[model samples]
Target: MVVPKHGVFTTRENKVYQMKKLLVSAIPALALSIAVGTAQAGETLDAVKAKGFVQCGVSTGLPGFSVADDKGNWGGLDVDVCKAVAAALFGDAGKVKFSPLTAKERFTALQSGEIDMLSRNTTWTLTRDSNLGLNFAGVNYYDGQGFMVSKKLGVKSAMELSGASVCIQAGTTTELNLADYFRANKMEYEPITYDTSDETVKGFEAGRCDVLTSDQSQLYALRIKLSDPNGAMVLPEVISKEPLGPVVRQGDDDWFNIVRWSLNAMLNAEELGVSSKNVDEMKGSSDPNIRRLLGLEGIKGEGLGLADEWAYNIVKQVGNYGEAFERNVGSGSPLKISRGLNALWNNGGIQYAPPIR
Candidate 1:
């Protein structure tokens, strides 16, 4: 993999030259000229383009967001985001290599350039966005941390448990926040920490802990595997903020734009009602915005460094954000998560898209 150039923004021509040289060396001569690259700090865009795929970092086994099948094929909301970026870059959604990562390894994996971007269920906190030398493109899921307790515990409220043992994932804000909530409430509790999501759930199930604390979305996703989902209840107490989204290493404008716009494309597609089932038919509608969006007319594709028909490619290949959500977390999905803050902005939700001009 070619490492992206870093530093304060400097010369555009320098980037082009570096990308060109790298492209010439890495890819076939035919591919060099066509690649529009913004690669490593001083390297050329062509160089990264020649590599022919985006490397995405994601959770190892979150059912609604990331999971690998017995055949090792990965799919979920996060996987679909990767597919959207791939579709934008190559016009083929399959052009990607997914790297499964643990919560502890996700940031380090991105900072070292081991992966290009992370679409895992990472929350955007002040400490992470500003202090960690990373950038969160935007919040895709506005979530909050909560707890799940088995009915056997007979605890109706989070505060009712004065000495509950909790199983929380390590290397996550959830662990720290879990402590803070208990401390501030003056409740005595014991925490069982584990490095992986599965391990944490198992620890809670094995009677090692009385509660499993995590993002409400994750708790819901994990609840299905319980011996009986109805036997466990998520406490109404939501302790901390968890605004999750795609993340990229700092200082790569070209790559950053691609990831940011790829997300925007999905959001905009949903706002325009351009679902896969009807996007093509909407192409002939009189709505000018829809025309521009679906690539039926206008230069929407080229404006984002993608083909003019890029939006069409996305809906055709991976589906819109709403479809991906319903497939992964909504009523149709195993998680059965409600569209709380993730609803469309106009519909009293937070998922607003920038104008696709």
Candidate 2:
């Protein structure tokens, strides 16, 4: 046996002792981590159930996505997503509240648990999904970055805006996309950053920037807010792929499933031709796909910890995805955006969802 100094041991004995000490010191931290993970897994759903509503985070005032009216009634595609989740959980779409958040405040609001889910037309990226400790439930809107300039500017193409001043919302992926796009094209421009889409549009209208650059859908939404909508035109150059969607914090599979399937229910309902106008009748559908989606049979919602009528409630109260899209941002609304890429997969677009079963 190797001799040791006072209060010491052999080398191998000391290594073992040190490892034991390290493990002993790490036990509490490991235990706490597990406890926290467990707490987070089901906590959001339990709290939402206890409170009787979902607190959804949304954009401050982005038209067609999550804007509020004169009487503070929130309506838009993103708002409909919140209502859909509420309807799925509580069987009542009205049992939800909206928190108007800026681009900068959105992720933090969700991370801090101030909101159960974020439906703020946020883009999903590798960094956001992995680094922010959040998971994007799914893509609700397939978008792309584009430029909008005053008709008087005679700018028919983004290539012409090389030396222009661009108004962009701060704390968004658009900034990075704009930089990459301009750099790749050997173009140079001055950027005027604002905190919100509203402020960004205001900056553009105030002549602080020569052009407003944002998601193509948002460009259309903002153009209508202009004093003279016809005075501006969106350029045809699409610079980046922006898949906008609802986001939920990581570590809560139950809550994640609820939010994801809520959107999925809307999408599947639309694909199956089950709208709010015909959901009740569709419940008696002979087609297994329709019957399963309406929770008439197969799986029947128990897998998601929801009642069999969960999907029915979502469709009846919030309508299908197609209805929400048309009412908020498509041809039925002021934006009048064509369902080019947002159309269903069977309809020559990419909006496809898994079956409820």
Candidate 3:
């Protein structure tokens, strides 16, 4: 893919171009607005309500996470999160417009009010949470970094990748993890960095690099884009922890709570055996937790400035967390990824959430 210009930025020589600072400097009023947290704090929810749609930030094209089709239709796990939020607020799942963003542009876009929330596959780290003035709602996908290489190379493991040139995208945790992994193993490899994920995969496909490294989930998505999908194998080694999720600017307690609970609604739905196919029926059940969750027994959404049936709208329109996973990246999708670490807490994984009550 081509690297975006101007409004978007890229990394070079290990230096991240601060588009946020530059853009803020260009508009003094905007800089001041940001300084006082007026850019995205308390205004987000009201702004979204006034606009009648949520402007969600997403990756340019990462299949099963966020990708647009040839006809401009968007789907994937991240896209569904945006839809879930819209469903909660407007009672309409389609009330959203997506802005495709690069890794370098995602943060600036959110900080500058270019997008309502960032549901792109971003890692939650201390540096980002504390320094960027952003808050991670919760982990939607638990992932780890791994390597991918063409089967022709005959490399069975990452340890055998010494001296190999690797293709990796810029402005991501994978870059630093690659260096650390090689240094820890006392191995040396040439790093070929690109501005976008598509560019990184294309470089690998064109033989500019001998291997590609990223989150294993991304490896699966990228492999499918290759000319010979079956020719590449993802290494079994997971190098670093990557808790990927949606992010909202810090200080918007109301907005943050809404987004956070939208996701938790889906998780709780799955845990409660609620699915879109049966949500309407489940709403009539006598279970107190399910009753509160579906707005039948409590004013659960009052504190979030939403209708009591907010979660019901999400489940009825967008399905639960497990439903989104199964269709986007699990058994029903091309990736067919197992819910290894993403399963519900009672079902062998740690995806737990607080009760709506």
Candidate 4:
């Protein structure tokens, strides 16, 4: 037998050894990719069905978006999105649980499967959608970053905020936008970061910071939480686009479809003049679009693996998108925000959705 040099191998042996090493090295990553792929392959619906509810991640407490009442009941535009999903899945809007999370904890909760979906007024960005293994279902709220200053500060515009100390929630795109806006305008600002929206508002209220910066919608929401809601006013300048919406894990397209279409169903229902008050009567209408959306004909939720009455259930239980907005954040609510960019496309705003059929 030929003696091989120590720690060396023949060409054929070396090839086998290298292949084995490569396989060994790749096993963990390969296993992870396969596992992720398997998990993404339409398992969430079945899992949710087995559990009898969707566990939704929401903001700890952001009024008009996601906030809990004194009685521990949650309601808001974002919460309604979760309710819509539950209604679509279970024919019952109440078949969902909410986990309150801060800006930093939202994604980890979704990634780790702590929640079936995140409906926490989260803004959709390229990094979040592509890099974070998540997908934004759709834009439920079209918003922009703005500053809220105490009227006592005599600041009327964001341009007047130069050198001001800004209280901002940490782990949000607001930080980057604030930096960019200040840098581009040759302004200097001292940032006071907090872990939650409530904390940021508290910092502002405590005079720890001169200004509070967040999405304009959130500014309205946070302002209402203050001891004197009218004491602070939102600046007129809109610094950045913030299309806030629901999010889900990337691997599960079926679950994604369910969430996306659930929102779309609401938008479509609004466009077709369907509302919670009239959904039952509209179900018998001869309009193809209305019929299709209400599951009277057309696809009838077959493609989404949901009941034919999924859209109807969503509208009846959760209301249409416009109703949710008006009820939670618009004229009817404390915020009383106007339907500016959030109006339907036909109504001159950009809130459009694909047809149900």
Compared with the true structure, all predictions reach lDDT values of 0.82, 0.91, 0.91, 0.91
Q: Give the TM-score of candidate 3.
A: 0.89
Which rank order by TM-score, best down to worst? 3, 4, 2, 1
Error of 4 at 208 (Å): 0.9
The parts of candidate 3 lying over 4 Å away from their true place are 1-42
All candidates: CA RMSD (Å): 8.7, 6.7, 8.5, 5.8
Tell me each candidate's TM-score. Answer: 0.86, 0.89, 0.89, 0.89
Candidate 4 per-residue lDDT, tens place, 68-170, comes to 9999999999999999999999999999999999999989778767788999989999999999989999999999999999999888788888889999999
Off by over 4 Å in 2: 1-42
Encode model 1's per-residue lDDT on 1-357: one tens digit a residue: 854465354545466767655674765535432332323434212334677887889898998898888999888888898889888888899987999999998987776666778999999888888877688887678899999999887888989977988898989999889888888989999888899988988887788989999999999988887777898889999999898899987776676787787888888989988888998788888988888877767777766677888777888788888899998888888788888889999988889988776
TM-score of candidate 2 versus the correct structure, residues matched by position: 0.89
Q: Between candidates 1 and 3, which one is better according to TM-score?
A: 3
Compute the lDDT of residue 13 as modeled in candidate 1: 45
Higher-lDDT candidate among 1 and 4? 4
Write model 3 residue lDDT over 29-79, tens digit each, in one string. Answer: 565566445463447888888889999999999999999999999999999
Model 4 TM-score is 0.89
Off by over 4 Å in 1: 1-48, 296-299
